[model samples]
Target chain A: MSKHTSMALRRPSRLSPDRLRVVVPILALLAMLVATGFLQPRVMSYFGFTLLLRYSLPLLFATMAQLCILVVGDIDLGIGPFVSLVNCIVASWLADQPWLCGIALVGAIFAYAAMGAFIQYRRLPSIVVTLGFSFIWLGAALLVRPTPGGTVPDWLIAATGFRTPLVPMPALLAIVVAFIAHHLIMRTAYGTVLRGIGSNAAAVERAGWSLLVGRALLYGAAGFCGVLAGLTLSGLNTTGDPWVGAQYTLLSIAGAIIGGAEFSGGIVSPIGAVFGAMIMLLSSSLLSFLNISTDWQLSLQGGLLTLVLALRTLSVWVGK
Target chain B: MKQIKFASASALALLMALGCHAAKADDASALKDTSKSGIALSNSYAGNTWRQQMLRVWQAAAQQAIDGHIIAKTKIVNADASAPQQASQIENLILEGWNSIVLDAASPTALNGSIEDACKQGITVVVFDSLATAPCAYKVAYDYVEAGRIPARFIVQQLHGKGNVLVVRGMPGTQVDVDEFQGAQEVFKENPGIKVVGTVNGQWTESVANKEVAGILPSLPKVDAVIGQGGDSVGTYQAFKAAGRPIPLITLGTRQEELALWEKLDKATPGGYATEASSSVPGVSSIAFWVAQQIVAGRKVPNVVKVSLLQISKADLATWLKVTPVGAVASPVYSKEWTIDLLKSIAANTAPPPSPGPTQNK
Candidate 1:
C-alpha cells in the first residue's frame, strides 16, 4: 500500500487519467440526479429514490458482469441472452425444482468457462464466439420458457423486495455489490496478477500463471454475476421473459465504458461502473420527468451517451 | 299563458324521467368529477409502425380530453420494449402522481408487480393491446380469436372449403398468436376439405414473412389460399408474385400497403380481387385512454374489456384505403361516448356496439 502511495505521489500525472475517469462518471450521475430533482422534487425523497433505483439493480449487476469480461480483455456478446436464460431457469425451475435450477445455473457457468477456454486455445475472436453462443443461449431460453410466463420463487421475491428505513434496498444492494467487487478486483494480490494478464498475457504466463485458468475463472465470474442479475430481475418483475434482457448487452457495454473501463483492458472501477449504470438509468427518468416527446426520447438518450463519452475524452486530454 | 306553462312543466318532467332512465341503464350516475385528475400513458415501445400509430392516437385523444377538462394533464413515456425499463417507467409515473395510468405493456406478467403497486396506491391502471396480467389492473384487449376466425372463414368461403391453405403466423408463443392460431386451426379442422399445407412463423413483420414464405414455397404443394394474422399479407402476396404463382385469396391486415396491393390487383384482374382486412386497431389506445379516464372518475369497469377487431370488407376497402396514410394502419379513433356505451354493453352482457370505421383521414 505504501509503495502504491509513493508511486502515485511520485507520478501523479500518470494516474490522473484513471482518476478522471472515475470522477467524471460520478459527476455525471450527480448532474443527472440534480436535474431530475429539479424536474420532480418528489423524487428527492426516500421512496422516490427507491422507485428510481428499483429496476437499476439488474442493470448494475449486468454491468458488473460485463466489467468482469472487459477486465479479461474479452467482450461477451452473449451476456444478454445468458442473463435471459438464467432468468428463465430461475422463474421456471427454481420454484418447483430447486435442485434442477441450481444444477442448470452451475452448468451455465461451466459452459461459459468452456467457451472462454476454447477461445483462448483456438485463438478465436471472442466477439464471434460469443455472438454464436448468444443464439444458443436464446434458443435454450426459448425452450425453457417459450413465452413470457413463469412464477418467480417466493423466497427470491422476498429477498429482492427486502427494504430498510433510511436507505433504499436497490441502492444499498448496488453499493454493497460494488464494494465487494472492487475489493476482489482491485485490492488483492491476485487482482493485480489478473490485471497483469490483461495488460501482458505473455509476461503473466511467463510468471507462471496459467492463462487458460485465468480466462476461465474470469468468465465464470461473469456468468455468476449474470445469474445474479437475472435472478434479481425475475424477482423484481415477478415473471420471466426470454427477450427481456436482450437490450442489456449494449447497455452493459456502454456502462462499463462510461465507468472508465477501456476496451483495451487493464483498467476498471467497480464503483464508477455502478454510478455509470445509475447515470444511464436516471437519464431516461429525467427525460420522462421533463416530458420530452417520445419521438425524441431515444435519440436524445443516444446523444447523451455521446456527450458523456466526449466529456470523458476531453477530461483525459486535459489530465495529460 | 297558464296552459302553456303547465304543458312545458309536464314536458320537462317527462324529459327528466327519460334522462333518469338512460342514466340508470348506462350507470352514468356513478361517474364522479375527474376534472383535476392527471392521466398518463406508459407505452412499452414506439419503434414499430403500429406502436407509433398507437401513440399518435393516444396523444390526440389525450389532448382532446385535456381541452375538454376531462383530465387536467397527460403525459407519455415509452421504453424500448424492455419489461424492466417499462416497470421502472411505471414506478416513475406513480411518483409523478398520475391518478390513472394506461399502459401498452412489454410483457403480460413482467409488469404485474409494478402495476399492482400502482393499484395499491389507489391509481387506476388500464393495460391494453400488449396487456399485463395483473389482477388489480383493468385490461382492454382485442378478441384475437375472432380476428383469426374471420380471416380463416373468409379463406374457407373463398375457396369453397376445398383448397390447400398456407398459414402465416405471428410472433410465436405470444398469447395473440396462440389465440389466433387456435381460432384458425379450429375452423380448418372442422372443414376437412381445407388442408393447411404449410405454416411459418412470420414474427409479425413484412420482410420476415416474405422470406419465410419464399423459402417454403418450393417445398409445399400449390397453395390455393393464404391466411395471415395481420402485417404479413403484403409479404405473402409479394412472395407469391415472385414465385410466379397465381395470387390466391390472401387475407390482409389493415396496413395501407396491403390495401393498395389489393386495389392494384383488383383493377388489373378481370374479376375484382376480393378479400377482407382485419386487425386490432391502433386507435384502441383511445379506448384505453377513455377507460382509464372513466375509472378515474369512479365509474365501475370490468377487469377485462373486449374491443372489437377493426374489419374492412370489400365494400369498405376503398373507403379505408382512401383515408389510411401510407405505412399506417386503418383505425377508428374511439370516443369517450363510445367507450361509455361499450362499458354499458359489457355490464349488460349484451352485444357490444360495432366500431365506427375511420373517423377522419390521417
Candidate 2:
C-alpha cells in the first residue's frame, strides 16, 4: 500500500516539461528577492534594483557564453582571461584608437574559431586546451596593460550606461541579452543541431554535419559573448583590470548549471541563466546587508548553490 | 644548425673575453668602490602604483646615498607578487653578499625563514611597507591605525560630531584593511552621533571605488562624510560628483591625482574643498632606506620603528601638489638627522627588548 501511494505521489504533476526547465531558476530568483527584501526592505524599490543589478550585465553575458560551450558539450575554461584580455584591449587600445580596437576584437573571435578547429583536429580535450589557453590570454593581457588602470572608451560607456525611465540599465540589458540568446540557442533550427551534437556527437556526425565547423561556430559565438561581457565590465569600472574577469569562469559555470543546463545533455535555458546570475548577485549583496562577515558569505553562497541544485535534482528525479 | 652553432660559439668566446676585460676593469676601479655598501631591495609585489612609487623612493634615496658616498650600489628584485619567488629572491640577496636587504614582504610569515637565514649570515634585513614578521628583521612601517584614526577624527570634526558617514574600505583580510577599519571603528565608537550608513570594498583602486560607490549612492540617504582607505579618495570623490551630490569631506591618500583634484577644488571654490588629507607617504620607504644606512653605519636601532602619518591641510594642498608629479605620492622625505631622531624616539616609546632573563639553563 505504501509503495503504490508513493508511486502515485511521484507522478508528474500538471506542470509541463517545458515549464520545468525554467521554473526552478525562476522560483529560486523569487526566493532570493524575498530573502533580500526581508533583510533590507529598501531593496524592493527601483533604486535598490539599480544597486543590486548594477554588475549583472557582464555576468549575464558570461553565463550566455558558458551556455554556448555547454550546448556544444565542451567547456571553455579560457573565457575568463579571454574576457580580461578583451577588456584590456578595449580600455586602452580602443580608448585611444577605436578603429584599431574594433579590428583587434574581431580578430580575437577568429582566433577563438581557430582554437576550436585546432582542438578538434588534434583530438585534444577542451578542458586541457582551454585551461592552457587561459594562461596565454592572461599573459597577453598583462603584457598589454600590466596594471589595473586604463580608461574604457566613452562610447561604450555611454551605450551601456544608458538608463530607462523606470527600469535599471542592468536589468534592461539582461532582458535584451536573454531574449537574443534564447532566440538563437533555443528557438532556431541550427540551435537544435548544436544541442543535438552535445547530446550525441556520433549521431550528429552520422547525420552528415561537419562537427568541426559546428564546434568552431559554437566557440566563435562564445567569443563574441565574452567580448560583450568584457566591454560591460570595463564600462562599469570605467576602466580595465587584467584581474577582473578571472572569477567569472567558475561563476558562469555555476550560473549555467543553476539555470537548468546539464553537462552531458545539451539542455539549457537562456532566460533561466540570466535569472541564475541575478540570484547569485543578489545573494551576496543580501548576505552583506545582513551584516554577515565576508568569510561566511562565501561559504553561504556555496551552500545556497548546492541547496538549489540539489533541490532541482530532487524535483527532476521525482518528476521522472 | 651547424652554421648557427658556429656563430654562437664565436659569440660566446667574444663575450667571455669582454667579461674578463670588464672584470679586470672593475678590479682596477675597486679602490673607488670599496668604501660603498651594497643594498638589495627584495620586493614581493610591484604591480600597483604605490609599490611603483615606493620603488622610486628607494631608487632615488639609494642614488642619493651613492652620490653622498654612503653606499655603492642598489639591487632591486621584483617578485611580481609571488611569495615563494620573494623567499628565493631573499636567499639570493643573502648569497650575493649585500650589506643590507630591504624587503617589502608579500606575506608576513612566508619569508621569515629566509629572513632569519639572512640575519644569521650577518646581513642587515630591513623590512618596510607590507612588512615581515621575523624578529631578526628591523621593520619600518607607518602607524596604520593612526592612518585610519586621523581620517575618522577629521571627518567627525568636519561634521561636528554628528552625521552619516560611509566607509570605503581597502582589500579585506589584509592587515592594512583590518587596522584601518579597527582604528576608524574605535573613533566611530567614541562618537555616538556619527552613524555608518554603509561600507563598500574599494580594494584601494580608483575605478573600483568609483564604480562601487556610485552603485550604492542611490540607496544611501545623504552621506555627510566619507572615510576611505588610501589610493581610493579620488574615485570616491568622482562618484559623488557623478551622482550630482556635493563631495563630502574625504581623507586623501598621498596620490598626486588626489592633490591635483584637491587643487582643482580649491581653485573652483576656495580653500581646497575644506578637507584634510593623510597618508603613510611613499617617501616613508626612503626613511626605511635611511634606517638601513644607519644599520650599515653601525648605529644600534630598534627592532621595529613606527613612522608617523603625514597630513596635508587645505592651505598646504598647493604646496604639496607642486612637489609631487601626477600619479606619484606626495610623501615628505625626512632628512638623515630627522630619520635618526625619529628612530630614537620610536625606540624610547616601545618597551626594551626582553632582557635576557638571567641566562638560560644551558
Candidate 3:
C-alpha cells in the first residue's frame, strides 16, 4: 500500500532514464483513466483494451516522430500536416499502383525531409517552415487526386487492418517501430548530440558538431514516421482525404509532451511515448464506449492534456 | 466600247457575289466557333477528390463547349486548404481583373468575407461542394446535411432500426462535419432501433480513424456497421476491418472505384463522386460557366447559386452517374457537340449548360 501510494504520490530519487520515462507516462495514463473515470465512471468498463490500442497507434507513431524533434530542442508544428501530406500521397497517388507505392512512399518521406532541411538549413523557424510545408503538402495532395475518393487494394487492406490472435497489425507495427527506434536512438552519435544540442546547442557547436545536421536528421526521422503512417494508413482506410492531415499535427505534440519529452530539454524516450499514446488512446476509447458526445471528446482531450502537465509537475516534486 | 462595258459589268457582278459569300461564310464560322475562355474558375484548394471532380467536370464542360462560346478560360488555384491562401489567391485574381471566380471554399465560414468581397468587387463567385456561413454567392453543393443523412438512413435500413453502430467524424469544427453530424442525427431520430453506440473524431485522417474505431470495438461488442463522414468513412472501414469486425460499412465520397467496392460488398455506395477528377472539371467549369454568363450579360451576378444533389443508393446511383454528365470526352459519348446538344435539348428556353437532364431532380 505504501509502495503504491508512494509511487503514485511521488517520483523516487536515483531514477534511471528508462524507468523515469516509463513511470511518468504511466502515471499520466493512469491519471487520465482516473480522471475520465471520475468524469464518467462508465468509461472504465466502456473502453475495452482493443479500443485503446487502435486509437493510440497513430498518435503513438506521431509522438515518437515528434519526440525526435523535441529532443533536439526544435518544434514541429507541421507534424500533423506532414502526416496528412504523406497520407494524401499514398491515398491519391498509390491507390491504383500497388508495386509503385513503396517508391512513392520513399519519395513522400524525402519530400517531407527536404522541407524540414530547408527550414533547418535556412535557419528559419521550424514552426513557420512546417506551417508553409502544410500548405504545400495540402495543395500537392489535392493536385494529385482532387476531392477525397479512391479505391485501396483489398489484400493490402486485409494485411494491415487485421488484429490477429490478440495483437493487431497496426499495434504490432507500432511496437516493432518503437523498439527499433529505441535501439537506434540509443546507439547513434547523433542521438547523443541531439540530447546535448537540446540542452545547449552552442556548447555542442563549440565542440564542432553542426546542430543543423542533427536537427535535419531528427526532423527527417520524424518525416519517415509520418510517411510510414501515411503509407500504412493508405492501406488501412477506404479513402484518404488531404484535409485529414490537419488534426494530427497538434496531437503528435501533445503525445510527445505526455511521453516526457521535456519542453525545455534533456529528456525524451520512445518507450514513454508509447505509454503516453496508450493512455491517450484509452481515454478516447472509453469516451466512445460510454457513448459520449463529440463535444466532450474535445473538451476531455484538452482537460486530459492539462492533467498530464500537472502530473508532470508532480513527478518533479516526487523526485525531490 | 460595247465589249469593254460588258466585261466590266460582269467582273463587278462576280465581285459582288464573292463579297456576299464571304460574309455568309464569316457568319457560319462565328456560329461554329463556340468555345471561349471567358470563365475564370478560382478553386480554393485541390484538397479532396470531390472538389477535384467538381473542378474536372466543370472544366471539361467549358473546354468542350463550342469555340468563342460563353464558356471561356480556366485558371485553377489550389489554395492547399489554407483559408488565407485561398482568400489571397482569389483576391489577387480579382485584383488582376478576373471577374468570374468560381470557388470551392476550404472553410465554409472562413471564406465568407473573401467571397463577399469578390461579390462586391463584381466577381461572379460560385461555390461548389461547400457553402459559406452566410450566403455569399451561387453555391451548387450537395445537401450538406444529406451527405451525413443518406448514410445514416442507409445504416438505419441495414440495421433494421436496431443495432449498435459507430460514427467516425471529420474535422469537428468544420461546417461539413457539423452539418453532416446533425444531418445524421436527424435520420437517426426516426430509427430508434439504431442506437449510435459511439462517435469518435477521426479528424478525417485514416490512421486516426483506424485508431479511434479500433479502440471502441472492444467495448461495444454489438456494433453492426460503421458510418463515417467524407474523408473518415474509409478509415472506419479500415479500423473495423483491422479489428476483425467483418461487419459492413457505409461511407461518404463514392467515386466509381468506391462504387465497384460497394457492389462487391453488396453494400450501397450512396451518392459518391461519379464525376472523376473533381478539381479540373466540375468546380472549374461551374465557375467558368457562371462567370462567363455573368460577364457576357455585363452585370455583376447577384446571389450566386450552386447545386450538388445527394446521389443515393445503388438503385439511383446509375441514373446519377448517367445524368451527372462527366466532362467533354468519354470514349462512349462525349463531344462538345453532344454536350451542347444535350444541354440544348434539356433547356426549357434557359441557358444551355446545367439544363437538368431527365434524371435531374431539380
TM-score of chain A of each: 0.94, 0.92, 0.82
Q: How many clashes show up per model?
A: 0, 1, 69
**Cα lDDT of model 2 by residue, B303-353, tens digit:** 888777777776666677777777777776555666766766666775322
Q: Which ranking of candidates, highest lDDT first?
A: 1, 2, 3
Model 2: which docking level applies? incorrect
- lDDT string for model 1 (B1-362, tens) is 99999999999999999998888855655367798999999999888888889988999998998898878998888888888888988998988889999999999889988998889889999999988888999999888888889999988898898999999999977789999999999999989999999999988789999999999999988888899998898888899999998888888898889889888988988989878888888899999999998888788888999998988877888888888999899999988989988998999999998888766734
Residues A1-320 of candidate 2: C-alpha lDDT, one tens digit per residue: 99987976787456644467688789878887887777667657665565466567878888888888888778879888988899889978886788998998998888888888888788798899999999988998988877655677667767765768888888878888889999988899989898888898889999998889988998898889999988877775555667667767877888887887877758888888888888776665665555453346547878877886787677777767
What is the DockQ (computed on Cα atoms) for candidate 1?
Answer: 0.60
The superposed Cα distance between candidate 2 and the true structure at residue B60, in angstroms, equals 2.1
The global Cα lDDT (0 to 1) of model 3 is 0.60
By TM-score, the best candidate is: 1
Off by over 4 Å in 1: A1-15, A123-125, A294-305, B1-30, B154-168, B188-226, B235-248, B264-274
lDDT of 3 at B216: 79
As a whole number from 0 to 100, the lDDT of residue A293 in candidate 2 is 36
Tens digit per residue, CA lDDT, model 3, A73-132 = 667777766666666666555656756767766776677667666866787877787777
Q: Which scores higher on lDDT, 1 or 3?
A: 1
lDDT of each: 0.87, 0.78, 0.60
